[model samples]
Target: MAQLMTIARPYAEAVFALSQEANSLAAWSEELANLATISQDPAMAAMIKNPAYSADQIVSVFTEVMGENLTKEGKGLLSAMAGNKRLSALSDVSEVFETLKAEAEKRVRATVISARKTTVEQKKKLSAALNAKFDAEVEITYEEDASLVGGIKIKVGDWAIDGSAQSQLNKLGAAIAQ
Candidate 1:
């Protein structure tokens, strides 16, 4: 995983820089996301990994699948990846690019898992709190897990706050066992 990121870093940084220069961050984001999706498809992965297909063939398949949605710059990226045999790194490149974009845009994505659906008011309050904490705009998504028993678990990037009853109970159980 780390090696993949390391291999993908230069590609991602180059794309990010190009997008910044062109003032097309959103467009590049969409392009990279689409390319990543296509490259990550099981069938496509098989094709990309197989030695039977030439670089031109791989580029042709990607170009056809992407159709008119792909921009000229995106096509160039595909050609470069194909030539470098780095098509498999598209997913990592997309992830790293998104991280760069989010940092530049001063935005953070958060996920909240709760025992039940959260009310709109609760979500708004949580968003506000996260915004205040991160000093950036917060985009939150919510999921419900009944096994949580109660309370909530919030994850923002590498940081996680697990306040779920199930988590607390597990910790208590471990302590008691010790």
Candidate 2:
């Protein structure tokens, strides 16, 4: 996984730089997401990994499938990846690209898991708090997980706040056992 990320980093950085220069970060983001999905498809993965298919053949298929949705630069990127046998790294590249985009835009993505559905006001307050904490614009996704029992858990990148009742109970159990 680490090696895959390492392999994808340069491609993602280059693409991000290109997008910045072209003032098309959003377009590139959408395109990379779509490309990552297409590349991860079982059929596409098989074709990409098969020695029987040439780089041109793989790019041809990609172009045909993506059609008008793909920009010239996108096509060029596909060709480059196909030539280099890096098609499988599209998913990692897309992930890294999104991280880079978020940083460039001074935004952070977060996920909130709660014991039940949360009110709009709750979400708003959470978003504001996260924004203040991260010192960046916050984009949040919410989920309801009954297993949480109560309270909520918030995750932003590698940092997480496990305020869920289930987590507290588990910690208490561990301490009692010790």
Candidate 3:
């Protein structure tokens, strides 16, 4: 909820600041992702909610479970969040941080689906073309769907370029009917 964002904003900001200072933005991203993933486990959720557990105990458990993924700063962050009873918001902070990171890097994550896998050369050319078109780095993820029949459909942000065989067939069918 929007109200949760309000509560989580300060925690996100604090983590962002720490990440910047340590020159560990990428590292923090990995650690936060790990934390968020683990927190999603029902068992972990219950442990975090159990009132009998001390904040330090929860922080220790998170650290031990997090393994080497938690750097010193990340561990400190976990402790702080546990102490403040804000661990539930770690996922929100991680999601917001990823958005901020993407914006800062001027990168867009794109999904490209085609009838089959694209060749390395085709991927290179497409990425180069997209980078030139967007004036930013493009991370292209591909999916294969025989249902596409042929051609490729690209979803970039709000825009989609539908160049699939199915679409062409529909257009041809409409023209024949008219």
**Each candidate: what lDDT?**
0.95, 0.95, 0.84
Which stretches of model 2 miss by more than 4 angstroms? 1-3
- Per-residue lDDT for 1-178 in model 1, tens only? 8888998899999999999999999999999999999999999999999999999999999999999999888889889988999999999999999999998999999999999999999998999999999999989999999999999999999999999999999999999999
lDDT of 2: 0.95
Q: What local lDDT score does residue 155 receive in model 3, on the 0 to 100 scale?
A: 89
Q: Which candidate's TM-score is highest?
A: 2
- lDDT (Cα, tens digit) per residue for candidate 2, span 1-178: 8998999999999999999999999999999999999999999999999999999999999899899999999999999988999999999999999999999999999999999999999998998899999999999999999999999999999999999999999999999999
The RMSD (Cα, Å) of candidate 2 is 2.0
**Alpha carbon lDDT of residue 18, candidate 3?**
78
How do the candidates rank by lDDT, highest first?
2, 1, 3
Query: How well does each candidate superpose onto the true structure, as a TM-score?
Result: 0.86, 0.88, 0.66
Can you give the lDDT of residue 98 in candidate 3? 80
